[model samples]
Target: MPHIKNALIRYRIIDKALGNTYNPYPSKLDLRHACEMELYGDTNGKHISDSTIEKDLFAMRQEMDAPIKYSKAHKGYYYDNPDFTINEKPLSEDDLTSIQFALSTLSQFKETEMFQNFGFALNKIIDRVNVDSDARKSDADIDQMIQFEKSTAAKGNEFLQPLLSAIQHQYIAYFMYESFVTQVKKQRKVTPLLLKEYNNRWYLICFDSVKEKVITYALDRISDLEIIEQVGEKPSDFKADLFFRHSIGITASAEARPEKIIFSAGNIAAKYINSQPFHESQKIVLDTLEHTKFELFALISEELIRELLSYGGDIIVQEPNSLKDELVKRIKQMKTNYNI
Candidate 1:
């Protein structure tokens, strides 16, 4: 393998290629090719010399404080620090990885009708990245590198645009919605206020004109949406922070104040809770050898109850008899159901 000390590559050219996750190890030849591609955009441009690449690499280490490294196994150059920043804050190695991931995900939808709305903007962003990976690498190769819970046919994505437009224009929209509990379909007029995504599902937070209150409707439950000409004024009191202030998950009331919820967790559960908190207000209140106590200010909603119940024996509610009693009642129902 030809050493980087013997190669010559420009900052931006080498920056993108070195940082790219898809094209991890670029040999001296690869770095040279990258420099040629970036500088000329075609091979017909002036050929870059090996000494030029080597001198540039030396300057990057000494002048710019770049932690560039050579990987013998991959036979290419890379940055030791994933977060290393170049002059004027160019994309870091981590940033390049994220951008490549985003591009790969976007490519999946390139052939779909969904790109019709934001294709130009997406293309522009892609052009700006100008990162290189192996052209022969297939989507399956990336799929092996990283996996996401990508639901190809996740319902209600179709409603995102129209609902977004309604909110943007303050348009009074009408939709026939099916209630999950009642299974009753009814046409309702609402002023679309906000679009919220929770748990990989789309929901519309809107002012129900008939009910005269803010309501959340799952996009999957919505159909026959019609944007009306009659505009509605956005509620002055409807602040996003104040609206979801009390709630743990999607269930929130703007008028409600958050209550102090304290819970004691087992050793295993405490670590998990500490790392991935249920809410932004979560804090360590008390810690002991037996268990750790955590506190959060949130509404005692069904989502909170379900979260607590999911933990099973790993956690115990410390205060607020209201929540404890509800859990007890739920446990009793489960016991009766299972004949425990």
Candidate 2:
């Protein structure tokens, strides 16, 4: 497995070098240099030999049946078919079995017209695998072995394709949006920047031209989306990761700064939180038989408070008096609702 993995890595490195038209022509020495730099750079300057690269090229050409050829005129290696990639090649029986099983599982979407094209594409791949009737039976057995949770159809999923198109083409999108605070629908024109999926819901993070700030809109709340011919202005300094750095979920307050939030969880909830953290910044501050204290940096938002509330009595906010006060207020409200 290690040998196969190493060979695959080398194959990818060579393939990329061969396909790169921008770089200088990749000679044998150049290929060795690239392999050494990528594969063995951190290992005390371990070197890759010319013989190994030659064998790799030979394996790709003969063993893998890849359309690889050397050009003495260009002094480099190139694929006879420019579009060819190693990933597109045929798979072994085991690989085919796994792929068939995965495809069959995904075939559940075949019932939906929105996913018809995706299902067709999966079927084409299965056909290309050339599985027999026995393999088909094996796929059925695989399906019995594995199962997915039942998922209801989400609203506005049909708009996913057009929104994706708008993001790709850099076109300004005009959509009617309804906020939870108001019953009135308003027209919005924005440049869609990124699509974020959280808790089975999709949100479009766009630069709102009117607001002059980045805003997130739930896809389900958006309607009558129209792509304008005018090109959307891409923000010069906008990065999706940085934009959501301090946010727990879709809700973010520009004025709110990230704070070091300290909290304690009971034994059971501690194990759960340790396995599946709320954020990347989660760190264990203290751990004992009684409880586990954890710390993380994030902006205080309603989403964060709601998440904390979900744990109920299992979690307790330690520091940040503001968050603790909010939690107390919410719990008081809940108590009032129950009249307890």
Candidate 3:
């Protein structure tokens, strides 16, 4: 049985050689040599013999209408059939949905126009996936299907080169930044470490030289930026991935450190949290019969508060009096608004 299986696999390899040909398929002995080389590389200087390959070819001739015929010059068999074609069947419904979701996600990058080719390639995949005769739409309709609009007219192309240069060289770029909080006008010089785009907004993760600490400045708030020759050094152990792993958005400040948070979650909320972790430091504390207790280690920024509020009654922050106080205040304000 094993020998027959190996022979079948070898025949499949021969079919592959034929499918890849422009005119005539490779000779039988040549095909076997190619397959042997591919299947078993020069691990111990061992290779399949020519006679064994010829016997395999002879055995294949008795099985099916293999387009192969004998050739004297090549001293082996060659393809005689000219009408051979490899037809790629259409993808399943699951494949189409998966392709659509991928294309939708890719549409987010069209803001920079760098991923336009991906959009085109996604269209081809969508066309192949959707084979229903009555289907009217094509994957090219992704442009209309997805609406990834950036709040600010982000000039990803015009500013990307200079910004990347500033980040890589650690040079300071002068930007006219308008603070959304205080609406303050400040000309600041910062040592760039990373650039992050979140929720359709671009942010620069850098150490403010004057402040001597890390700060996140929104790119949309930047008016005019020019890279300066002056450069500064980042922390020796500073890793962007680790730094932002516990953060939500770019609100993590220099003073922000990992803090332990205990919370109770409903079954639905627990599943949601498990699907996408609240923080890298998050862990399931108690998985009981009714509810779940979760411990989170993350930067307790305004983003965290907002996320908790969005979940409403589904989650309850157990410890950290500061967070509890804030949540209570917000809840009280909500109560006062409704006067209930």
Per-model TM values vs. the true structure: 0.60, 0.58, 0.56
Report the C-alpha lDDT of model 1 over 222-301, residue by residue, as the tens digit.
87878887798677889764677667788977666678899999988999989988898999988999999999988889
Top-down lDDT ranking = 2, 1, 3
Evaluation by TM-score, superior candidate among 1 and 2? 1
Give me the runs in candidate 2 sitting further than 4 Å from their true place.
1-147, 253-255
- Please give the lDDT score at residue 35 for candidate 3: 65
Ranked by TM-score, the better of candidates 2 and 3 is 2
* Model 2 residue 162 CA deviation in Å: 2.3
Reference-based lDDT, each prediction: 0.76, 0.79, 0.68
Top-scoring candidate (lDDT): 2
- What does each candidate score in C-alpha RMSD? 17.6, 15.9, 18.2
In candidate 1, the residue pairs with backbone N, CA or C atoms under 3 Å apart (3 or more residues apart, or in different chains) clash, namely 7-53, 7-54, 8-52, 8-53, 8-54, 9-53, 26-76
List runs of model 1 lying over 4 Å from the truth: 1-147, 150-152
Question: Residue 117 in model 3: shift from native, Å?
Answer: 18
